[model samples]
Target: MAGTRVPTLQPSFDELSEPLRETTFVVVDLETTGGSARTERITEIGAVKVRGGQVLGEFATLVDPGRSIPPNITILTGITNAMVVGAPRIDSVLPSFLEFSRNCVLVAHNAGFDMGFLRAACQRLGLPWPAPRVIDTVRLARSALSKDEAPSVRLGALAPLLGATVRPDHRALTDARATVDVLHALFERLGAVGVQSMDELVHAQRRVSTAQRRKRHLAQGLPAAPGVYLFRGAKDEVLYVGTSKNLRQRVRSYFGRSEQRRRIRHMVTLAERVDHVVCAHSLEAQVREQRLIAAHQPRYNRRSKQPHRGWWVVLTSEAFPRLSVVPAQSPQLGRTANPLGPFWSRAAALEAVDALHSAVRIRRCTQRIRRHDPDGTACALAELGKCGAPCAGLESVTDYAAHVMQVTGMVAGSNDDVLTGLHQRVVQLGSAGRFDDAATARDRLAALASVLHRGQRLAALCGIAELVAARPDGSGGWEFSVIRHGRLAGAGVARRGVAPMPIVHLLQASAETVRPAAGPLPAASAEETSTILAWLDQPGTRLVSSTQPWSLPARAAGRWQPFVDAAAVARGSLSGADLRRHAVTG
Candidate 1:
């Protein structure tokens, strides 16, 4: 007797005990009109509510699917049209079913099929889904039973193996009742493996890999707030970066069943630690995520922005200025010349420059011509009546100064000259019935406007040394942003009943000092500045303080359109119709 071995059912100190006895489960089954939840409708609903091995209640209903049941479905379910003639529609019966299973974990043989129909019904009726926790006995049986123990985890095959009293016959209540027995038997087998806690029982569904289950402890210290998180490898290099409104929950889910991406699963396997930065708001979290991805260039983060790689349309400071596309860091830009863009591509910058040439003549030639002393040969544009031919001495230096002033004004935040010049060409082409040519000119107008619009806005923000803006956070709190030279230098929140000005001053003092770089986009990447633009553009945002005037130009392109006749009359630029043809210059 001293040498004999005895197995005890009770757990020792470290093992969690008696989780099934404390939890409630609502086993559910549905017979629908067809296989697809989107096109089909539910014909019957059956649910058995239980807790601690006792039957708490039973919910059974005949749902009128609002359509005739298909012959195949009726034959399978044995619920004919005449049988459900007096049944209540799903809209009328859903409220009672929802109340019956409120707060209980849903159990089913194949839960996706059952849950999809229920979710579709809720969406159709404009009802909010409680989105309760679910357990599938099929997954549980596969995890708990060997192939020899149960040949199949289907309800009919599992009923006899698990000693279920009810025989499943494709009917709702019978299948749900059989699933209840299958669920409990699987739980008993899991108990032998020391999985007794509610969390462990949910984990035994086997959708979660064992490697991921072991790594859950890494998420324990993360805060439940809006933030950016970085997953670091064993060597302390960031492997992946992400942002979430609830940092703890989002990170913890990587170790749970729903996260099944092969790449993310591998990321979890290699992940040794998680680091987080809590943010004042969702926008701040998003901005920080972009900055982090830009900084680390983590292998798993897609399309990370490489700062200072953007192209710009620059005007040269030579004897004869010409439009050229160059990168933001190019030294071709001079102190007297302001660049037109930080365009995404050289081709895009060239297109915008072509549109500018079509509007006002910035000579297309690369040759440097001195005033009143050059070869009088004309280029192609000069022959096409497009250029003033300053290189050939046909146009004087005094005459070229007018075009220079127009371009300088346009570069200094006005689009009237370009808009007017492009408009006359578009109208003449259209009046000549050359619609395709007009369309091409109009497209040029759009491209120029798109790039210059963003360029102006970003330049205005970059010109500012410091700016503070606040917006309501929808919870009696104020979300504040401190920007320096177009970068999100600092962000914070002043909760209810607190004065925001002091916080604004504090954030301003502690914010990052961003120096204006040589190029047009002085600080921050285009993506980062664009993110800040989106936040400041949101409704209810109010400017708290600023060092420079944060404004667009009076003749900025947004309010102007290329309607020569209508605009000339409305703006009174032309004195009379007699001079309308000569009023706007090419």
Candidate 2:
């Protein structure tokens, strides 16, 4: 399709700014046989070369996927075997594509997915993937769109909602054109936030990457318990708020050793310190997390806490007016007489209500009597016995109130009686020949069970806590701990007075790896940083005491010497945030 009759109505590249139009952006899209990276293959590739804000040329070709396209995928992308027949394989076309993209940035709607696919294809071809930088219009839209705009963030949702007036053909070129329009509109809108060059965009993306990395790392050591965690940066300012169970465990996960550990390592390098609060239960933790995340507006967490913009579960006043989830910012929240969730998403709210109905058999439909006044009949749910048909006047107000009480009970994580009844129903279904019904009942029972099982469990060894410290001896030797509850947890199997402490200390010290900070902290002085590194490079030392874990005494100078020396000699490289701030200032 490169040289065919191009659409005349398409906007010319000259309409864009000199820099943007001359950027040689490869406006690209890929048609995959399925969604999964592990299981799917790309069937078509499409790109249009834009320069001087005009489409200089176009490129598109189907590929023999070497496997049957799933029927659903065929329907979605309209690409079939016949379309790709005799078409060049990815290997035949990728080389030329790479050459074309050389020195030019890539552009895509969901660029991550596309880049992943491209990387996979390159790997299959036994070629080193040149990961040229990419610009994602999807990211741009989220950053650029105002809060008052429609509650749509998807590509198809964006065009009409953004007032772009572009055709929604789902073809590659058309999609690319629409994206260009969106980018143009955003640039026009991004007055102060406008990026002057491609490098600036790259810098912004790195910040995002760093934030995501930190979140994932902190999540690593999270225990199954409920608690709250904080994300702090330089000057001890909290950058984000989160709640989790098992504080140490959750914080540890953020620093998990993996290729994707960008945020964890970056943040750790930048962080001056950390703080946390343990919660008694998961709900308490969640509520606290939400409040804090909303209050702090952390850089890393998803922007879910806009004022009056969260989601809500609305119970309508009319007969059979079904419970539905809509934005809290919407007028729908005000109209509903009864509602359950101001949940983060409509899906989350619906899931909550569904669990309530499944557990307590609460009628989600509105009152039958009220429906008649509104000139509507019972909904399908009420007619099908899924609802109690309050709209039909079959259930009294007292009865309806009882159902509402049951739902409230479910949401509050209380009402063991209702949960017991639900469990009994599941047991009965399983004992009978209704296996399918039993399975569904069992799932619902599990959901309800989790809500009730939110509180903390006392550790059996809670009576005693131990602190252990380790320091490198200038040679290959290390010294370590055996402290317990502000004292030694126990005496070790050491010969004579030494006790068997060294071995235990080493094991404990190795288990507790420090996580990197998420943002920049003031850089350690050259001497201090070097000393720290030197200490780290030396043989491990263990600190042991017979006291509570938190009561372990700080290590003395002799023990700290190795680290001190390392810090003195080690380089004090600029942290991720430091670099960004510096670049901006410069």
- Residue-level lDDT of model 2, residues 1-586, one tens digit each, is 0000111122222222234534777878778887776678888777867765676777777788888888888787777778878888888888877876777788888898888888898998899988787988777666556446746767788877666656546566677677766666665643234333454344333323333334443443334444678778887777656666456544544433322455445655565445665543333355456556667776666643553354555555543344566765566554543334334456655665676566554566433455333334567776666776665566656666776666445434344456556657756765665655655555444433432221100110122344444453233333333322211121112223333345555444543232222111112111222222233235553434435432211221122233333322321443444432222110
Q: Any runs in candidate 1 off by more than 4 Å, and if so which?
A: 1-26, 30-45, 50-56, 61-107, 111-151, 157-174, 181-214, 255-266, 334-336, 560-586
Candidate lDDT values, in order = 0.78, 0.52
All candidates: TM-score: 0.74, 0.34
Candidate 2 local Cα displacement, residue 281, angstroms: 56
Residue 218, model 1, lDDT: 84
Prediction 1 TM-score vs. true: 0.74
For model 2, what is the error of residue 297's alpha carbon versus the real structure, in angstroms, after optimal superposition?
27
Model 2 worst lDDT window (10 residues): 454-463
Question: Ten residues in a row with the worst lDDT in model 1?
Answer: 1-10
